[model samples]
Each structure stands twice: as C-alpha cells, then as structure tokens.
Target: MIEEMGQQSLFNILISLMVLIAVWWSVQSIRFDLFLKDPEGIKAKGFMVVLTLALTYLVTSFILNYLNWSQTLRFLF
Candidate 1:
C-alpha cells in the first residue's frame, strides 16, 4: 500500500510537470505583439502564461484524482 501510494504520488508529479511544460511551450509559441500591442504586452503575456499553467495544473490534478477515486471505488465494490 505504501509503495502504491508513492507510485501514485510520483505519477501525479510527472503529469503535473508535463502539463507545465506543455503550457509553457504553448505560451512561448504565441505572437504576443499581434495580440497585446502595448508597453505592458510582455507583462500581460507573462500573466496569461502563469494563469494558463495554474489552470492546467488544477484541471489535470482534478482529473487524475477523480480517476484514482473511481478505481478505488471499483476495487471496493
């Protein structure tokens, strides 16, 4: 049980890291100049990137937890 918990923790960390990298890559690929034509454009872009990363992490974690819970429930039943 302890080993299984550790494995699940590691898997969650890996998934979170992957999601972070993907979000960063997507944010970096965007043409900020075309979208935010202002002196604060870079700041805006950074904020958006952070926001997106946070949201992605939240969603990914939620889905993972839900899946894990469902599997546990199946085993219980």
Candidate 2:
C-alpha cells in the first residue's frame, strides 16, 4: 500500500513528523527536569530529537523492507 503512494509524498510526511516529534519530545524532556539547569539545553534536546527520529526512520527502513510503521508519525504530527 505504501509503495503505491509515491516516494516523495511519503518522504515529506516522514520528515515533517520527525520535526514535530523533535519539538514534542524536547518539551516533555524539559518538563521532566532532564535539562533543568541550562535553559539552552532545551534547544539542544529538540535538535537531537529531530536528528534521532530522522536517523531512526532511515536506518529502520533501510534494514527492514517489510516495515511500514512510519505512518504512526502522521497521527502524532
């Protein structure tokens, strides 16, 4: 089913969710005192989350051709 949607649409949707997750995760982390001392830590955490999600999507897709869990991100975004 995913293969029928065209790759560019899927790619855009994936990247957008990755970015949104980055923001949400970063805020949650900050709320938990993960970076209590330095205010700048929030920004850093957000960037890391975005990069992590993007890398995760790429690595998972590359290693597992049968996986199609990327759509879960769409609901969250």
* The best candidate in terms of lDDT: 1
| Model 2 lDDT tens row, 1-77 | 67766785676668657655654565454443454455457776676666567666765455344344564566786
Candidate 1: residue 8 lDDT (0-100): 84
Clash totals for all models, in order? 0, 0
User: What does candidate 1's lDDT look like per residue over 1-73, in tens digits?
Assistant: 9999999899988888887777777767666667676725678867776777787788788879888788889
User: For each candidate, C-alpha RMSD in Å?
Assistant: 3.0, 9.5
Clashing pairs in 1: none
My TM-score estimates for the predictions, one after another, are 0.62, 0.33
Model 2: residues with Cα > 4 Å off, grouped in runs: 1-40, 66-77
- Clashing residue pairs, backbone N/CA/C < 3 A, model 2: none
Q: What is the Cα root-mean-square deviation between model 2 and the actual structure?
A: 9.5
| Model 1 CA deviation exceeding 4 Å by range | 34-42, 73-77
Best by TM-score: 1
Worst 10 residues of 1 by lDDT: 32-41
